[model samples]
Target: MVKRFGRTSFTLSIAFAAVLSAAGAAVALPQLSNGWPYAPTPQHTDRTYTLAAVGDIACEPDTTENAGNPAQLKCGSASLGGMPAEFATARQADAMHPDLVALLGDEQYEVGKLNDFEQSFEQAWGGLKMMERPSPGNHEYYAYTKHGDNEAAQNGAGYFGYFNGHDQNGTPYPQGQAGNDTSDEQGWYSYDIGNWHVISLNAECRSAAFGNDCSTTGNGVLARETQWLAQDLHADHAACTVAYWHQPTFSATTSTADAPDPAAPGAGSPEGTAAQAWWKLLYNAHASLVLNGHEHVYARFRPMDPNGHFDPKNGIPQITVGTGGEDLDTVATSGGSYTNPNLVTAQDQAFGVMNLQLKPNGYTWDYRPVQAGPGFGSTALSYHDSGSGTCRG
Candidate 1:
């Protein structure tokens, strides 16, 4: 209700599913309570909430995989893209009165190498680097082609070394603190933010690549991540719930047969058979929304149950947020636009990040696309919706 026209921040107790997640130093979040550094609070009383999703923050890849090797690296294999833009996005989010960030995936380009931890992601998102409630994407898996063909390095390493993805509270995943029974680095995790509890899944399923998993050990990380997703979702009834990953479970963009070089659809394009089960899991749980990338363009799916169940009573909204610094992929449609009943809105022109204002009613999703030429930064795309809890009972 607050009609402030500038940046701001607020102080509120952020939380989760029947448990207390770790809390920050009680530092006042910018833009959520007070006016932005540029704007002063007006002597008026009003009610409001603001959250922004700064589209995609990543490097522009030359090939499909985009991850460059040490031999001939491009995009610096940076963790995230557009440092200044990311900073702006964070500031914009902070200023917009955000309770927490949604953290859409593909955090790092190329491989999930150790170097990117500092260079790519940390450098780009800045303070955002502190709280990473991440879902593992194909790229996050650091997946690599065993064949090692010409552009092999671009796919990144499917190494699956060791990772401990935390929730917004900064605690280890699966509800236990460092116990061997359920303790190990993993791709999927969950956390609670504000009145909502969220799960970050590792949808970058690459079990088929290795005899077991890409790792020298036959530990199937993809399966582990999937199991965790189910448990995470069932653990609570937060006012609202959502999940973030790297690949769109459903995107209108198709893999065009006639495109440039390796970027072609036949070989590798992102969406695979990995997420079918997870898709169903989401439908049953009725997650409020799902965020993903890897298609190079932005697309939003209509609210429907998984497998086209089309349960108007409770369907999740799926969105594709792939337009960061990466080049747009050839426009193709998995189905129709928003009018088609089966599919929602679809377009090739949209290229930017998403800005969201998370509220009790729902989070407002704004697609801000970048313009042609240079220095334009980002433009406001006229499309967004509220997905507070289509699945809430």
Candidate 2:
């Protein structure tokens, strides 16, 4: 069922109240059925629909250093503790009335505590919570990794608590209700929107186990998720398909240098190699598109095959839209700075959202930068990029 919102606007005051409600105060969240992770009911007739996608959002105000900072809870300022980019993107997405919202990952910054998501993320995007189809990010599971042992933590309990909380019977999913074991391990699943088949996967392998590569690791959640992807793709007959996860298989920026054994937990480093295993599955299935978050910028690469070779006729295009609300990262300026030769468009300064108009045989994308507005920083109004492509399948 579609949810109704009585209030038509979001302000700092409302965000503060949301924080209090998250803390033990009585406040009812929007009603979501047991089938919280859902897709639009498939239609046989040819049609089109739009969805907003982005990630790396919501900053936590109550850091260890600022735990008792009263002013931080005010939610008045966009920069100090408040997430200006999150509010801007959420508000813009709400106005667009897209069929759904695809939150790539990093929904909450700096450890993804349940309270942080409620206060910061829900405060801005709560009105559309049920419309969210999300994948877990490094923030959600990094605490479970060796690199993030000391900082804020949750072991992903909070992330799952918010998304996979209750079923229609009011039974909590964490108790093994409905056999939904994917709740904690690797929240991977596939669904259909129009003629499109979409898959969301968990790529933060370090979160599940220490010293594990997300792409090539042969056991545990990564292995199971890879097996599941193969089965899901073989079963689906959609003409157009897209797969999304936290990290990108190909990043155009120099930020991702390969880590030397549990290196620092930073955004840009040589990473995403583990995702190559997943890429091969999608490629063999003739997938149409791939989406990711983590680079903290907006980048669109040319159509390429599973091995990162240009193959516009049968390869998949990947877009990194990690500029939701968190700080941005610079794209490599010099040629040969990155591995992927198909780097088409990349920008790091503006905060924005990527809109995809999915058709039966292809899709069109529009990256709309959120201009200066309440809770948003000053930025010129313009689209970073816009184009359409036919489905390779």
Best-matching candidate per TM-score: 2
Indicate the residue-level lDDT of 40 in model 2: 32
Error of 2 at 245 (Å): 0.7
Q: lDDT of all the models against the reference?
A: 0.44, 0.65
Residues 77-190, candidate 1, lDDT per residue (tens digit)?
332234443444445444545434555555554454434534545554545432333444455544444324232231222212212334555333432211111213343445
Report the lDDT of model 2 for residue 220.
Answer: 55
- TM-score against truth, every candidate: 0.62, 0.77
RMSD of 1: 11.3
Candidate 2, 1-393: lDDT as tens digits: 234322111110111111111112333222212222332343643878777899887776554553544443324444432466678888888877777678898888667766677777887777777667788788877752332234545546557666667565533365221113343245666657777887777777775432355544344556545655665666667788888888887766653344222112222433376677677778878998999998777899888776677886887888999878766666765445443446787777677889998888889999978843334345545546999988766
lDDT of 2 at 16: 12
Runs of candidate 2 with Cα error greater than 4 angstroms are: 1-44, 63-81, 144-150, 166-172, 175-184, 209-217, 255-271, 335-340, 372-380
